[model samples]
Target: MMQRNVGVVFGGVSPEHEVSIISALQAAAALDRARYRPVPIYIAKDGVWYTGDDRLLDPAAYRDLDRIRREATPVMLDPRSYRTLELVAAGGRRFARPARWSVDVLLLGLHGGPGENGGLQGLCEAFNVPYTGSGILGSALGMDKVLSKMLCRDQQIPIVDFVAFRESDWGYHEEAWLDRCEQELGYPVVVKPARLGSSIGISRAADRAALDAAIEEALRYDEKVVVERAVTALREINCSVLGDVHEAIPSVLEEPVRSAGQELLSFREKYLRGGGADGGKHARRPAKQPAGAEGMASLDRVIPAPLPPEKTAEIQALGVRIFQLFECSGVARIDFLMDGTTGQVYFNEINTIPGSFSFYLWEPTGVSFTDLTHRLIDLALKQHHDKNGRVRTYDVNLLSERSLQGLKGAKQRAG
Candidate 1:
């Protein structure tokens, strides 16, 4: 049996570049060699694509961007050929041409911006390639924090009250808008860019002065910004969901314990210090059994959580529901914020392509990363088959012999 060629694309012009590389390399290393051949495709910050042996499985090598570019062959998605990604190279002495490589599936590891926010998905659609993760609509919806929250509210998924405003609107009536935010959400609000991740442009404001500064900071990242009431004394719980829109399975919940003084998990805290001393890069572990009931014990968490069984079930069911609501396929990590005292969970956000692909969460459930990757590849192929089965074009010549005599008479009369 021939192994399917899987193109795992990662690294991009997003702030999450380093994290994406880590996630992609992990996936590439864990892919079952017997069932699939993992091809490393790197997208540089300059927007150039590359593929080759040198680009394989090592996060540290990416630090020297220029070196990687020189070593790897430039590649691009071939819009003309379905399920094919071409490698463009300078012509040899006798022939002035380029080379190409056809891939079976695209496993996207790029996070944020064009990668996670539908740009790449749109390209995949145009190229008729089966890529893992969400479709265009789901990717777009999931990336836009404001829109996703709106959808969640309509679907009765628990979400915090938020006010979304455009920069143009803020420019026109800054005072009026600020007044509305204060009146509606009050102080100590969380301000964030409408469509970014990794806590890039997220801030917590305890007062009007801070709120003003936070909004200014968020505007640098996006045109739209969302201001929401901060969950004081909150516990952040994350759950990974697998499968497609129709049916999904939830991983055990993880409680990201932050420092006592930290109001929110900043980018520095999440990727820098490693969620704290007991929960950094090497210190981190995956979730385990009894399902969501145990919380995330091994990985600096309580596993299944210390919450009641009913609460655990509610969070798990909501996780699956949110996955379907966003029309997400493959795998995604949906984060929730629970009031420490009340134990009420609110939909926080969804990571379409979570870091490390959330394999650690699945490991506890007896699913290895290799098996998880295979499942994603299988799902992608199944979706491709289902799409191909649909009739996309019809054999009709509408312009062949249209009678214009009657239409001309009608037009003349109208004139």
Candidate 2:
């Protein structure tokens, strides 16, 4: 049997570029050779696309990006056809030729911005190509924290109270808005950019002065900002969900332990090694655990989350609900914030394309990384097959007959 070609596209013009590279390389290395052929498509920080042996897994090689660019060959996907990802090669003393390579499916490892926030998904949809993760609407919704929270509210999913404001609104009525926020949500609020991830442009304000500063900080990253009541005694727990609108499954929950004086996991803590004192960097590395421990087996997670079975079930149920509500496909990691004392779980955010593809979470459930990648590729192919069967165009020529009649009516009305 012929192996399906899976194009894993990663690296982007997002703050999460380094994390995306780590996740993509991990996924590429885990693809089952017998069932699928993994093709690495690297997109540089400058938006250039490249594909070659130089794009293979090598963490140390990334520190010097200029060297990689010099060695790698340029590549691009043909928008005219979804089935092919063409390589643009320079011909000696002649015009460049378009060399094509067939792509059976797309495995997106993009983390934020254009890659995760519907831009790449929209491009794929334009070509009618099936890619893993959420569709355009779902991806957009998931990326925007404010919009996703609104949807969650409509779906009865519990989320922390938040106030959203546009940059223009803040600039025009700063004092009035500040008074309103203080009166309603009060101080000690969490300020975050509406669309960024990895805790970029996120800050906590303890008073009116701090609140003003936090909002200003957030505006630097995004035009829209959200202010919410901060969970001071917070326990960060995350669960991974898999499937589409009708069906979904949740992984075991894991608490992301933070270091002293760290209120939230910053981008530095997430990607930079040894950046923290309490081994925060090492916490992200892969780990081994006993059997039957579930998704928490591969990562440094306290198996079962040390919460009541009922509460654990509740979080998992909510994870499945959020996955279905957003119409997400393949896999996603849904994060939740629980009050350390009250056990009150509030929906934090959803990572449409999570780090390491959340493969570590599935390992404990007996799903190997290879199996997980294959599952996503199979889902993409199935979605493409189902979409092709739908009636996309009409046979009737309504424009042909209506053109003359419409023109005559328009001329009569104008006269």
Candidate 3:
């Protein structure tokens, strides 16, 4: 009914920082101005948070970080107030106090690092702010590849055989770790950082040499690494689930198109290429559009993935299960690795805050980007209300004068 200000928080000190920017800007562009006013809350790579005018909505304007910082107003979240962001003083305000702004809800567009890995979500909780997407536990669990697989395994959800190890486990014992991998999971393994997405630190290892190299690369991004037996004749199918654990729905399936000889979808293939052309009307682009302007929307993929009706339903059901399992709110894209040779599907990983919010997949389902954004904001507000409705504090004061006198008497008796 009434207009609400939604703070679209994005950008972070992460390998996927640029991708986050693209996703956030797309979401800001799609917000229904009639129902919600989109506020830009940008977290720079340096970890400083900023807020600014319409310049924040221009994707091209992000090429120069220094210019953005110069023009943007740096701000910090004040947990003392409900959803208040206080401006940090830069120039002499002389006698004037710093300004503050409030948002009805926070639309999280962050991808990796603290932004999506529970840190920002926790900050929102501390600020008592309503935010979209997963909560602290859900975000933490979804970001962790090892934990996601373990939970899936415990639940009997099919997952590829994986050997998870921390950097400490391989310290000066590379031979032992190599032997373990060679014995348990043989060659042609996929190595990935345990907590990162956008395929930033992922590689396919064919031999011991490549495996070693892959592990080292993965360690650069995260202390933990996951080496899984590569699915033969792999077909990556993704399904996006929207809403919360209580009531959620799955969108149409998507099979991301990979390039020939590309063992895994590199960051380039995922974002750099022009994919909007194949994405239907909302994803269609101009002939002279900039490279990678579409973000994940630009990645070439088949929507409603030419799967049999049964298979489509199976994947969608699985997607919903995984979404509820992770206690995820808002929209998340659950990826499944299907063995083309056997048609066996294995739960791969979950994107808690998927790029472009997987709008392409939902578009065919009759959910426009604007409508999707609206749903997410509404969900955020409802969740906040539900969370705060419960009793959080006690009326009794433990440190009252009577209680203090009793403590003093106990001390005297002990003496």
Which candidate wins on lDDT?
Answer: 3
lDDT of 1 by residue, 213-268 (tens): 99999999999999999987799888899999878999987777675788887666
lDDT by residue for model 2 (1-415), tens = 8987777888899988877877777777778778777766778999887666523555445667776576665676675565544445322211112255567778898989999999999988888777888889889999999999999999888898888999999997998978888887886899999999988999998888889999999999999999998876899889999888867899877776565788877766555424322323224333321121111122334654778899989999999999888889988999999989888999999999988778767877988877888888877777778888899888765456566466777656656
Among residues 3 or more apart in sequence or in different chains, the pairs in candidate 3 whose N, CA or C atoms overlap within 3 Å are: 275-298
In the range 1-415, model 3's lDDT, one tens digit per residue, is 7888788998998988888988888888888889887788889899988887666777787888888877777776665566544444344222222366667789999999898999999988888889999999999999999999999999999999989899999899998998899888998899999999989889999899999999999999999999999998989999999999899999999998888888798898887764432342235432323444577887778887888999999999999999999999999999999999899999999999999898878878999888888899889989999988989789777567666677887656756
Model 2 regions more than 4 Å off: 90-98, 273-300, 396-415
By TM-score, how accurate is candidate 1?
Answer: 0.89
Model 1 misplacement above 4 A: 90-98, 274-304, 399-415
Q: Candidates ranked by TM-score, best first? A: 3, 1, 2
Model 3 alpha-carbon miss at residue 302, Å: 0.5
Q: Positional deviation of 112 in candidate 3, in angstroms?
A: 0.6
Positional deviation of residue 48's Cα in model 1 after best superposition, in angstroms: 0.6
TM-scores for all candidates?
0.89, 0.88, 0.92
